[model samples]
Target: EPEVTQTPSHQVTQMGQEVILRCVPISNHLYFYWYRQILGQKVEFLVSFYNNEISEKSEIFDDQFSVERPDGSNFTLKIRSTKLEDSAMYFCASHNARGGTGELFFGEGSRLTVL
Candidate 1:
C-alpha cells in the first residue's frame, strides 16, 4: 500500500533557528494535513491543505510557520523561527476526501527537539 513518508525521523535544533520538515504524502490522496503532539499531549491539528492552498489552519499555525507542496510528491513544513515549545512529533497525513468523514493515513512522525 502507498504510504506517507517523512524524513529525518529525529532532529535536534536550537531555539530560534529555522527548520524544514519534509513529507511525501500518498500519491492519490487529495487532502493533506499536518499535526503535532507535544510530549504527552494529544495530537493537535496545525493545518490542512488541498488544491495547492490552505483549507484550514489552527491557531497553532502562527506567522512563523508555512507549508508548501514543492512538487507532485513532496509536501514540506517550514518554521522560520523555532522555539522550545516547538519540540514535538510532527505527523504528516493524507486522505481521500471522497470518503464522507475524513480518515487519514499518517506517517510515523518527524520528532523535533529544541533547546
Candidate 2:
C-alpha cells in the first residue's frame, strides 16, 4: 500500500532557526494535514490543505508557520523561526475524502527538538 513518508526522523536545531519538515503524502489522497504531539500530550491538529490551498488551520499554526505542496508528490511545512515550545513530533497525514470518517494514514513523524 502507498504510505506517507517524512524525512530526518529526528531533527536537532537551535532556538531560533528555520526548519522545513518534509513529507510525501499518499499519491491519491485529496486531503493532507499536519499534526503535532508534544511529548506526552495529545496529538493536536496544526493545519489541513486541499486543492493547493489551506482548508483549515488551528491557532497553533501561527505566523511562523507555512505549508506548501512544492510539487506533485511533496508536501512541506516550514517554520520561519523555531521556539523551544515548537519541539514536537510532527506527523503528516492524508485522507482520500474529508466527508467520511475514514482513518488517516500517518508517517512515523519527524521529531523536532529545539534547544
Candidate 3:
C-alpha cells in the first residue's frame, strides 16, 4: 500500500539555524497536513494544505514556519530559525478527498533536535 515518506529521520541542529523537513505523501490523497509531538507531549496540529493553498493553520505555526508543495509530489516544512523548544518529531500526513471519519495516513516522522 502507498504511504507517506519523510527524509532526515533524525537531525541535530543548533538554535537559530534553518531546518527543512521533506515528505512525499500518498499519490492519490488530496489533503495534506503537518503535525508535531514535543517529546512526551500530545500531538499538535501545525497546518493543513489542499488545492495548493493553506486550508487551515494552528497558532503553533508561526511566521518562522512554512509549508510548500514545490513540485507535484513533494511536501516540505521549513523552520526559518530553529529554537530549543522546536525539538520534536514532525509528522507529515495526508488523507483522501472522501474525508470519511477524517482518517490520516502519517509518515514515521522526521525527528528534529535543537541545542
In order, the Cα lDDT scores of the candidates are 0.95, 0.95, 0.96
* Per-residue lDDT over 1-115 for candidate 3, one digit per residue giving the tens place of the 0 to 100 score: 8999999899999999999999999998889999999999999999999999999999999999999999989999999999999999999999997857768999999999999
- Give candidate 3's total backbone clashes: 0
User: 84-110, model 2: which lDDT tens digit per residue?
Assistant: 999999999998885667679999899
Model 2, position 80: C-alpha lDDT score = 94
Q: Which stretches of candidate 1 lie over 4 Å from their true place?
A: 99-101
User: Which of candidates 1 and 2 reaches a greater TM-score?
Assistant: 1
lDDT of 1 at 100: 54
